[model samples]
Target: MKNITCIEDLRQIHKRRVPKAFFDYADRGSYAEETLRANRSDMERIKFRQRILVDVASRSLNTTILGEPAALPLILAPIGLTGMQHSDGEIHACRAAHAAGIPYTLSTMSICSIEDVASSVDKPFWFQLYVMKDRGFVKALIERAIAAKCSALVLTVDLQVIGQRHADIKNGMTVPPQWTLSKFIDFASKPSWVSGVLRGKRRTFGNLVDAMKGSNVNELSVWIASQFDQSLNWKDVEWIRSIWPGKLIIKGILDVADAKEAVKTGAQAMVVSNHGGRQLDGAPSSISVLPEIVQEVGGQTEILFDGGIRSGQDVMRALALGAKSCMIGRAYVHGLGAGGQDGVATAIDVISKELSTTMGLCGVNRIEDIDRRVLTDHLQTNAVSSPRN
Candidate 1:
């Protein structure tokens, strides 16, 4: 194969290798996709200042996240059905993240079970949780992560109601996708993906099946659909904090008020994400809200930025805006879909290089040196006047 140097290249290859349903499931966003498009566009709008005539040697991307050292300020965000991107996808991705000296978060809805990943990899990975109504199952899942020696627990709190992704509805996306004539024809066109799937276990939500009582692949979808508790409140967050002993992260905090609440719940960190624009179509981009959230809670808790982070420059932008670290979903998912382990490694390399190059251009030698001065916000010119003033 050719050198996959950029995320776009991986996306193209992924389109060629994975089935349409699975590819779109990872690639596309919810209705209108306004926030998704805005996430990228907003990053582009924040232009960096270029500098010259300095001995730009020995740059470092090293930083600390959640009190642990990281090779860079990037973490692999948990993406469900990672296995469908490639066989044993979660395991391979986790391995790649470990090799790169970064943290890998395994989703509660992943195709690989917690033990499956733990047994296959040497180091511990973070586990993401979506609070379910089944208190027993929730307790078991947390215990499983603990048994797996996970160092962190990321509690995703935004997806109380699943957003309507048009592509998912159109593709009839599910675990072990329904065998329709259209899907079969799509699969036929991708023989390499077909071969990989044939060699691996069935493409069901591996983490959910055989673990939750009375739930198999056939009933998995119904169970998942019913599990997410819409009545979840701050008390639930407190309950989760009380149980999970490891580092706690409250994922999906978009508002500053909610971010403060996360801190009150004793969360060590909060990921400023809009569920990657999958939950709410009109919510502001995660990057746009990072500055305020950071300004509010930076001294008290770790702030992580997630949505629309596609390059190393994006990581820098997030840090400049006060995010301690950034997480990637579609970018890494594109890499996973393209070439599995190697693809993921290539993706990390590409972003790391991009970050280094961007840092050098902006005259910043270290990741810690990046700050708001590197960015010129055009929005400042259109400031709104307060009625009280």
Candidate 2:
């Protein structure tokens, strides 16, 4: 197998390995995909200053995130259906993150259950939640997270309604993929992927299936679609905060006004994300909106960033722009789809090495030392031209 050197390389391998339906589920964004493209392009526009004549020795990427010490200021964002990428994908990713000294976040819709990941990994991983219409189920899920020793609770405030992804509709994407002639033919082409799936017992959404009473694999998609509470508001955030005793993170905040409100809601941190551009096609990129969100809530609460972060340089750019840390969804998922556990390890190593090299080249010795001075005014102009600006 060729060495997985970057996230793009992983994506290439993933495309070749996984079925068209699963691959597109993780790869594609919502209609128009304007915000998806903008997320990456906006980050690239921020030029870094090439400083010289500085003793860049004994560099350290070491930093603390939400009171947890990390090898670097980066977190693995929660992505649903990771198991489809690889067998027990969440467990593998969480183990890789634990070994790398970074936080791994388990999604509310993950194929692996909270207990499944918690029992497999040495360190306690963070748990992400979606506010559902069933308050009893939500409460029980929080209690289960605590039982699993999850260090933090990430409440995804957006996604009241699922966005229309043409690929998913076209592919008829669902858990335990329906066996059609085309799908069987697609699966037969990849013997290695098939073997991995057969070796694992949990092939569907493990968390949700067991969490809800009288629910089975066949009812998962319908249950999830119906459970997403449309009436979720700041009052619900307060209710969640009251139940979750650990660190609280409000995810999916793109607006500065929302960030300000999040701070007021007593959240310890807020993720500046556009749901990876899966929701709100016309929304601004996370990188483009990050600076403003930071400016508004930087002092009041920690600002974590997500959306379009595909490499280590992107992580550095986000950190330099005032994000305390950054999260990646598709990058690691690509690795999981490509080669399972080894692929995820390779992905993390690639990003960490890239982060170190980029920091050295930019004359920044530590992640904490990186700031706006290291970047050019090109990002500011892009931000100004943005529709939200």
Candidate 3:
């Protein structure tokens, strides 16, 4: 705790806490790893122009996401099996995010169910849904979210087909970890993780297990694999919109054409993402194509950005280039994997301070005032030239 200062610091601690297999699942990416590497590198390439002598004392990181006030311009993006990262991880992350005044999104494949988080937290959190082939179960999931009073319904338009992660195939990853001879060796080294998981409320996918009675991890994986609807299309958004009356956010938009189509779905906001470089191995990094997508649909629909956002400086860069807000996945997962709820709280705290400092250095007093003027001329030409609506 005394040495923790950044998200990567927690990441190293997390690596030491969890088993090698689960850590690789969260940390690695799809085949060839080109897009995964590019996500971070591309963000790093964007330079900033510093300004001083402009009343730098006062600054604000306060902003809004889908009409709800936030402590900062950040949201915890959904990550599957977050509960496996640390016992009851989703609940801990939700409480920490709610306490920090930012939104937390629960994944459809989370180890903790929707009801589990709704019952624990006082305020409503966002929910992320993967459109499955099982429309009946999908509709039931939507009703569950509505019944829990979720503030927003994030429709992840990507991952209609699962990306082949080489690490996952090699590790033999499962929901409730199977302690085979190979896994046993890995689990033996992670006593803390095992103890925490053994003491947790639920081990396997809490949302799916009851519904999938008489099924084990192998069967559950097979069922989930068959559920990803390769035929998912824009019409599904209309169907979802008909059922979910709350704010709808279409995530995983990376192309200008897709951004235009997303706006037609009547969504309040759309996240410009490439699935954190997890799917489509050779796709352009989310940050690189953000300006193009924003330019095509900037005024039509609010654009939220994700992928390769590790620091508050990255957050300011995305916002300056026409993103209304940014979502973080690996950063908070590092916190959760490293130190449970306290680590998550610390991750938010670190980013808040960094974003505030970056804002002040760029001569802005409020997050709303951030624009391309803060960027170098080169970035300005390549990025959105104006603020987003």
Candidate 4:
């Protein structure tokens, strides 16, 4: 723990500690991974304007997300199968987020159900919903989230049609992981991971117990895969908005038109994301489209950024471009896989510290002070490129 200094360190430990399938689930991107690589590359292309001899006194990272005070302008993005990364992973991750004074979103496909996580955590975390073909079940899930007192509802608008991730097919990834002789040997190599998962509260998807009742692993996997509704549209968002009387955040808007439409849904916030490069392999990077989306709808609704955010500097970059806040998926998941709750805490600490240091280096003292001025002129001039149009 003392040796852990950066998110990459945690990622390396995560890859080594967790099984290959689960680690790759967080690491790999869809199809050819062109967009996945672009997410990071475009972020790197923007350079920060460093300042010197500024008042080196007090600095703060506090801000409000969704009309609520937060320790930082960051949220733990919902990652499905989180519990598979570690034992009771959602609960642990939520606890870590609460301890850090930030919001943690539980995925619809989590191993720990809303009730499970709500009971375990002291604070009200956010919930991410995937509107499936079953409207009844979708309403029920929203009702459950309401009952659990979730502070926000993150409706993922992308993923109406699933993308093909060849690694998942090759790895044969599934809930409760089907075990072959090779898998057994791999599990044997990571005895600690095996033990933790074996002693976990539920090996299968905890939220889908009723839906998957009396079904075997193969059938359950098939059912889960087929649940992504291709018919999803803005009307479904309206339906969900009617049921969920809380802060609504629409995730996965990469186009200016989509951003405008998401704001029209009466969502309090919308995320500029490309599903972490997990969908639409040829699409533009989230960062590349962020400025344009902000230009079109920055005032109409709060814009949150996601994709390729592994460091505090990355968070700063997004905020400078117009993201009111940021969401992280794989960064903290690496910490979770590496060391569970403590690892998660470490991941948060690492980023927060780096963000603070970066803030001071860039001559900013408050979150509100971060804007396009912090970026190099070259990036600002070349920002609106083919991606934005």
Which model scores highest in TM-score?
4
Candidate 2, residue 370: CA error in Å? Answer: 0.4
Off by over 4 Å in 2: 211-218, 378-380, 384-389
Q: Count clashing residue pairs per candidate.
A: 0, 0, 0, 0
The alpha-carbon lDDT assigned to residue 250 of candidate 3 equals: 94
User: Each model's TM-score?
Assistant: 0.95, 0.96, 0.97, 0.98
> Candidate 1 on 243-325: residue-level lDDT in tens?
88889999999988899889999888999999888879988877777777777788999999898888888888788888888
Kindly report which residue pairs in candidate 3 clash with one another.
Answer: none
Residues 274-368, candidate 2: write the lDDT tens digits: 99989999888888888777776799999999988888889988888888998989998999998888888888888899988888888889888
Instruction: For residue 15, give model 4's deviation from the true position in Å.
Output: 0.4
- In model 4, the worst 10-residue window by lDDT is 380-389
Clashing pairs in 1: none
**lDDT (10s digit) by residue, model 4, range 1-389:** 78999999999999999988889999999999999999998898888999999994689999999889999998999999889899999999999999999999999989999999999988999999999888888899999999999999999989999999988888888887888887788888999998998898888887777887999989988887889899998988888888999999999998888888898899999999999999999999888888888988999999999999999999999999999999999999999999999999999999999999999999999999999888886654365332254
Model 3 over residues 206-290: C-alpha lDDT tens digits? 7777667998888998898898999999999999999999999999999888898888888999999989888999999888788
The whole-model lDDT of each prediction reads: 0.86, 0.87, 0.89, 0.91
True lDDT of residue 75, candidate 1: 96
| Model 1 weakest lDDT span, ten residues long | 380-389
Q: Best-fitting candidate, measured by lDDT?
A: 4
